[model samples]
Target chain A: MTSYTDKIREISKRLLKEGKVDMVIGFTRGSVPMMHQPMFAKNQGDVDRFVWDGNCGINLANYVTDRKEKIGIVAKGCDARNLAVHIVENKINRDQLYIIGVPCTGMLDRHKLTASVAGEIESIMEDEAGKTVTISGNGFSETYDRAAVLQENCSLCMHRNPVIYDELIADKVPEQSENDVDRFAAVRKVEEMTPDEKWAYFDDLLSDCIRCYACRNACPLCYCPTCFVDESKPQWVGKSIDPTDIRIFHFLRAYHCAGRCTDCGACVRSCPMGINVRAMTKKLEKDCLENFGWEAGLTTEQRPPLDTYKPDDPEQFIK
Target chain B: MKNLLEHMGIDPGRLHFSWISSAESTKFVEVAKKVTEEAVALKSKEKKYMKTKPKVA
Candidate 1:
């Protein structure tokens, strides 16, 4: 398989040399092994620092919002969708972007790998074409099929190719067939419980939250100048990590991205406490798709489901 | 949720509520299919309108 790293370098260099963009946002080798950090390259010399691999999973779209300089961004499927959401939400202008779209198969779930392996993980490597991962620790090493380690959101993704792009770096990746995939199976399981049971379930799920706000900062959809949590005029949620406050914080966070979330999994990936925040967002996504036949970031022209309404809408739930 | 969305001028279609016990698998499928059809129809109508009266950007 062709190296995505090489292609990203070529495209970024060309864009910078041609003055097509003021800066290119992509990934660079992280200080730690088995990870990558988002970086910006403003000149041709800096493009060489750009890298792409299974570890380059952080959504680059988060860095593009409110950027005055023209930007060229390397976007995976979810990142592209989030950009589309940004365009529709007026967070960023589409005219200011030169999107380098990547047809992502999936991203590696680092937390899963960390939990399954023994000892401190010293080094890790992945061969995307071979669909395998090799990890070496303090005393042992092993290789496993890459599919077994895919991020949960990626495993269940319906749109694996960019729904919008300025230029695709490679041929579009085929979407996973929905025939047997139960993307909402977990959500449905939680829904089957009684109100008290459901409450306790989420309470336990978010119990480890430290109120760090990494999830919010990582999300491209979250760009409000004053987040509701930080509002002083009418503090919507407590700043402390009280369980009830945490619960409301999560609920509001998920609600804010109701129709706009692409299920990018960025929030879960960035959470220091390893909370499965997708549990909340996915429920809203299922509801939006089921009720309004809407998926966020598919088109720039169409307003989000919640932004527009028809006179005769499904009101079975409303009294 | 429906009440809040309604007050906000968002389509009530944006929210759906139904009760399906684990034993009522058939009822679940039936409700799902009906809701899917309704949403599809609403989207089609919106698309048709947008095509006829394209919004100026």
Candidate 2:
């Protein structure tokens, strides 16, 4: 893992010095414990600030959307997948990119970590092996296996290596085996409930939403200049954080990401309220995979499932 | 959603409708083949008309 970080810096320096890219977008050590911030490097001096650890969870692909600069980006499995999505959507050109692919093990779930810890985390140190994280604060410290604290999406991730890349920092890690857990069990549970029960479930699930739009801002696929929430000509959705408005916002956000979302978990991670926004997107992902046999960002040539439909697509819900 | 995209000038072939249950393997194959054929046809249609469509000044 340390070697990978060194390789990233070395490559980033070369890309910048040789004028291969105008900028390199990667993670820097965050001011807080267990948090890493996205930083841009324009020169070799700036490349020294790059960091890669369990906390580099935020999707760096979000920074590449619609940017004209010849850029170098550090991408984990999900981030790389989203980058592929950006190329296919024409938000960014493939030629403009120098992807530094990182085969990710998984990202640590901050929410779960906080829940597991009783006090504030003074500092967190991840093992060089990327297997365990030691968190210390408030006169106590504990080390836990990295897997126990993995983000929900990462735990269920099937693609842990970059689907597309200009260069890989390390050997590609093996993808999580399907026998780990039933990824869609929660969605299946929701499906088993009655209509009213399902409605009640979502209502309770999303009741805490403040409508800050952090999730939208963090998503790589949500590059629409005018999001449905901002449309005033028809006023598709209300601006206020009304329950109905929140539901509408989540619905539209999920719908917009229907076939393109790689389940990178950026939206879930960015949400201040710790809402599982994937609840909506996961169902859509399942539908896409099961019905259309489509997984986002696998190839640049293949069109998204929704964007190119078959004459006989699943229409069980349609009259 | 399909209706809205079509209303915005997206090709109708981009939207498809079919039904297949988990138990129905034959139906899934049949539907999959039909969809692929339609998609191919639609692509050629788009290419043929792309040159003929009048350009907006």
Candidate 3:
């Protein structure tokens, strides 16, 4: 994706030089391998530090909330969706910013890559043309098919092109067809389990949780000024890493994102324990899609299903 | 909230929602009876989310 990086630098430089925006948000290589950190470029000089590749998994939309300054942001498919959500929520105005949209071809899953190799990965190289990834550490170097290591949410993504943008970095990539990807396959598997079995499934899944809140911090949807977990007056969830507390935390967090989540996979990516947190959120997403014929971030003009009242809304669960 | 809780393996019967006004006393009683029956049926299953003594310490 060298061309992507070059184009981003050129655009960001021009935007900065023209004083169109006070800052530009993008990704830069992180301190470690297979991790990219969000970089804020306030001037033309810092624009060169911006880079884009498979490791640019951190959603840049998380940084733009409630900002007063005019901004230009590098948004991939998921980030752009989150931005649309932000605009709909009135967190930021559309006129105050410029969106540099990039057509995304999924990101690599660090957990999958790390698990496939034996030692610490020293470097990672992507062969965009060949659709292969090469990783080297110490005396070992190995290559693997890119599709095999793609993030789970990305592989199942139907929207690989930004839904909204001011400018495009490349021609829009073909989106994944619904027939090609069963986005709810994992949720379906969980749904098929008995209540006791499902309980055990999530219990085992959250067993490694450290209550670090990395997932919440990483999520662009989690922009609450006072998150439920931190509210001392009404302690909705215990601070301890008790299984019940962890379960409640996950449940509530997913609930909060009910109609707003884009299934961007930021929570799963940020989890230090490698927990698949999307399992809970995706169920809500699936329900929203099936019951309400709604997909979050697709359009800013319409409010999400949960946010509005409709007489025809399903009430099958009601007595 | 109820749908998600059920999706996570909680018994669908454990939680109930109804839209009965105070004027509709008969409907309220019927809904309450159904909810109680469902909760009683699930009494055999172990409580899932109740807090217990810390496992870490």
Question: What's the DockQ for every one of the candidates?
Answer: 0.04, 0.03, 0.73
Off by over 4 Å in 3: B55-57
Looking at model 3, residue A36 earns an lDDT score of: 94
**Per-residue accuracy of model 1 over A10-30 as CA lDDT, tens digit each:** 999999989999999999988
In model 1, the runs with Cα more than 4 Å from the true position are B2-57
Please write out the lDDT profile of model 2 over residues A1-319, one tens digit for every residue: 6787789999999999999999999999888887789999998999988988888888899898788999999999999899989888898999999999999999989888877889999888888888898888998898999888999999999999998899999998988776977888888887666544665677688888999999999898888888888889998876766565677688778889988989999899888899999988888887778878889998888889877768898666342
Provide the TM-score for each candidate, comma-separated: 0.84, 0.83, 0.97
- Model 2 / residue A78 / CA error / Å: 0.8
- Model 2 ranges off by over 4 Å: B1-57
**Pick by DockQ: 2 or 3, better one:** 3
Q: What DockQ was computed for model 3?
A: 0.73
The candidate that achieves the highest TM-score relative to the unseen native structure: 3
| Candidate 1 chain A, poorest ten consecutive residues by summed lDDT | A191-200
- Tell me the lDDT of model 1 at A252: 80
B-chain TM-score for every candidate: 0.63, 0.66, 0.76
Model with the higher lDDT, candidate 2 or 3? 3
Best-to-worst order by DockQ is: 3, 1, 2
Candidates 1 and 3 compared by lDDT, better number:
3
Q: Indicate whether candidate 2 or candidate 3 has the larger TM-score.
A: 3
